[model samples]
Target: MSRVIIRLLLTLLFLCPILAHSQLEDIDLKELVAGAQEWAEENLDTNVLDALPELDRQKAQKFLRDLQKQFQGEYVINLAALRETANTILPLLESHEETRPYAVWLRPRLDYLKIADEFLITIPPPKVEPGEPAKPIPNPGPIQQRAVWIKEVERRPWPPAASNHVARLKTVFIAEKVPPELVWLAEVESSFDARARSPVGAAGLFQLMPDTAKRFGLSLWPRDQRLQPEPSARASAQYLKLLYERFKDWRLALAAYNSGEGTVQKLLERRNARSFDDIAVYLPAETQMFVPKIEAVLLRREGIKLAGLVTPRD
Candidate 1:
């Protein structure tokens, strides 16, 4: 299958559960699959399609399928298996100009994979009692995970693209009345790479999804403004500002940014929670990791805690 088809299948397998109660809840599974297959056939990147035929089809399909499964699995511990595959794929993706944008998207996430593996190695598995089912061990809470991520991130050098983009992006955030330091979000999202794109269609420096991008006044056709740093940054900042306003807390705002506002809001209401920590465990594993990862990135880049961030100025 083509990469597009593979991604579509993986999305259906993994993301459907996460989206079940969100806006896409009512979507018909069969129709969604048929539409995705048609889109894949119609919109396959010629270069990628051409390249696919030259590979050993079975091996390639297996590799791609396994990669997608591990990457999209609900548990962070599953990411451990992806580290080697990521290293191998990163260089290959970077070697082709047509595929380099994917490399940009994958590059920063390699850190997450590495740290997740380390976390698994460091934390002992929960002990099981005789004649009882062995339950999975829960990950450390966000506060503990944030400290771990801060240490990991602190040792890394700043992404080169950030030097060129941060000043410009910060100005856009400030113009949108967002806290300028929050512009470092690009570092966490895309490593400040304007061409970065997730397989699920989030794009650009801030990785704005199509729906969110359009909601914030970005044009998707004729030209995808999400790939333009200033426009994407403006949309991102506005979205963040709106999220912060809704949650009245930066940690909650960041969580909503990653996992959808509806998802975070519902969790908060269900749990009677006012803070990210209260609902963190109930969140999808990616969101659980994501909020703390951003906190670590912010702390490492700007030396500010999420709680220390000020509201957008008028």
Candidate 2:
């Protein structure tokens, strides 16, 4: 009897903790990642946790810490909030519960992550600080101005001679991985006038609308540099490059450039187009014509000499 009672006591003691833990509901990596994805998509600006790499989870945690430090007065963390934060951040990289269809607790959180991801994609990369030792600048000889200007002239855009400035602008863009076709957009939108203004409050040679400019963290101060022919061209090119990384298709990227990425993404969700021409018509009218015009000019310029024309080299 004594031996049996001892054995029973030992079993109960071991089972007690296990039963308690089970009652409390244990969360693990799988649960955390799912909860995070759902929560982030629903609440924050975008699901920053998703587009960024999985190895960066520690960094994301650090970011949260930094945020906590920066705004100590504004935010506080509790158990529930920590669970929510984990849910919002983790699934962005890891999806563990492949078989489980749904976690009722995690669904609401993923909604916010979706929105956060949307906004995050639009945010430009941080700029390198000035006063870092300057790198040697390479000199690109000659401007592709006439090609840029004549296209503007054809559209009856002001500043008829503006296309002549393309060669000068080309130098800045050549080093960057920007598509050459985008240079013509500057001409069509702003007439190569650094101080160009549009009826809808688009400014700069690139005609970046104020909201679009702001989204890139561009400041509208005494004068928006985005309107400046050279700077605006660079900004536009960089923006396009970023879009290309997101969509992988130049046409879809261009559509995202003209319209918002959200718009392009929605269309992609709808038409699921395989090529630019397939989805080009779905873009805004001006954007619809935008790609073709740029293509036409670029093709003509590249093959002008082949076409038996005296295309001058700058």
Q: Indicate the TM-score of model 1.
A: 0.81
Sliding window of 10 residues with minimal summed lDDT for model 1: 13-22
Q: The CA-based lDDT of model 1 is what?
A: 0.69
Model 2, 105-176: lDDT tens digits are 222223223322332343333445786664322111112222332343343432454666687677656655
**Which candidate has the highest TM-score of all?**
1
Mark the 10 consecutive residues where model 2 has the least summed lDDT: 70-79
Error of 1 at 289 (Å): 1.9
lDDT tens digits by residue: candidate 1, 1-314: 46676544434422221221112323332343335434333322223323333553333334444444443334667667778877876766677554566678878778778877887888778888999897765666777788888888886778888899889888888888888889888988898888886544567998887777777999876577899999999999998998888889988888778767777787787789988999786665566677788878888888898878765566
For candidate 1, give the lDDT of residue 18: 22
Q: Model 2: runs farther than 4 Å from truth?
A: 1-159, 304-314
The candidate maximizing lDDT is 1
